[model samples]
Target: MKPVLWMKSSCTTCRNAKAKLAELGLEVEVRDYFKKPLEAGELEHLLPADPAPMLGTKSPKYKELGLKDRHLSKAEAISLMVQDNNLLKRPILVHPKGTVIGFDAEAYARLVR
Candidate 1:
């Protein structure tokens, strides 16, 4: 299967990831999570069970929503992310070998190459 890149169009990291994939001559399927939000199952598959990695702690929305103080379970976090794609960290690259969350140039190179 072709690697799938879950990303937002406006994110610089997402753009960089896409460019790097191209540079490596790897064909990828891009999924704009903003336009098409991820389902719960998809989120569960992409994210860690801990939910901390899936949650975008740095997002203003997280602060605005006052989620920092709240301890959300895996299900709650997954549900929240499904409702709001912005709650997720951008540029999740899914490959046959493994999945990489966020932008890691070295990881991308290792997986894509």
Candidate 2:
């Protein structure tokens, strides 16, 4: 199966994930998720759960966009992420039906082996 990794160069998390994958000898195709927002269908599968707690900038956007006070449905979150890729969590690793966020070692281990 092919490995699809949505990556942003400047993100340390993405770089770490890439390094881990490389250490495990897993080849991945990294795409710039910032420049290209994912489709709703794609983003939907990658997101964690409802409310998307992990999704959103720790930066001022979280407060500025009022995401802290807002509650969004799955579809709403998907739409928002498509409109702004930054809304999606970093280093999303895709493999078949599974999508792992933040380059988690345990999760990526499943993909690695």
Candidate 3:
């Protein structure tokens, strides 16, 4: 199966990831998650069993939304992400081998190769 890249157009990391994929000559289906939000099932598949990986803990909105004090289950975290695309990390790359969250050049290279 072709790789799928879930990203936001305005994010620099996402842009870089997209460029890297292109540079590697790998075909990808790009999904701007903000424009076309992910479904709960999709998020479940993309995220790890732990909520921390998918949850954007560094996002300002995370604090603004008062999520810092709360302990969310995996389902809850996915629900929140579905409601606010900003709550999810950027440039999630999904391949047949595995998935990569966020921008890591080394990881991308391994996946692309």
Candidate 1, residue 77: the lDDT equals 87
Q: Which pairs clash inside model 2?
A: none
lDDT tens digits by residue: candidate 2, 64-113 = 67887788788887877777777767777787747776778878887756
Worst 10 residues of 1 by lDDT: 45-54
TM-score of every model versus the real structure: 0.89, 0.79, 0.90
Q: What is candidate 2's CA lDDT for residue 82?
A: 73
lDDT of 1 by residue, 26-94 (tens): 789999988888999988777777777767877887898899888788898888888788899888888
lDDT of candidate 3 over 1-113, digit per residue (tens): 98999999999889999998888887899999888899999888787777776667778889898887887788988888988888998888898978888887788788766
RMSD, one per candidate, in order: 1.6, 2.3, 1.5
**Which residue ranges in model 1 land beyond 4 Å of their true spot?**
none
Candidate 2 Cα outliers beyond 4 Å, as residue runs: 48-54, 57-59
Model 2 misses residue 18 by how many Å?
Answer: 0.7
Candidate lDDT (C-alpha), each: 0.86, 0.76, 0.86
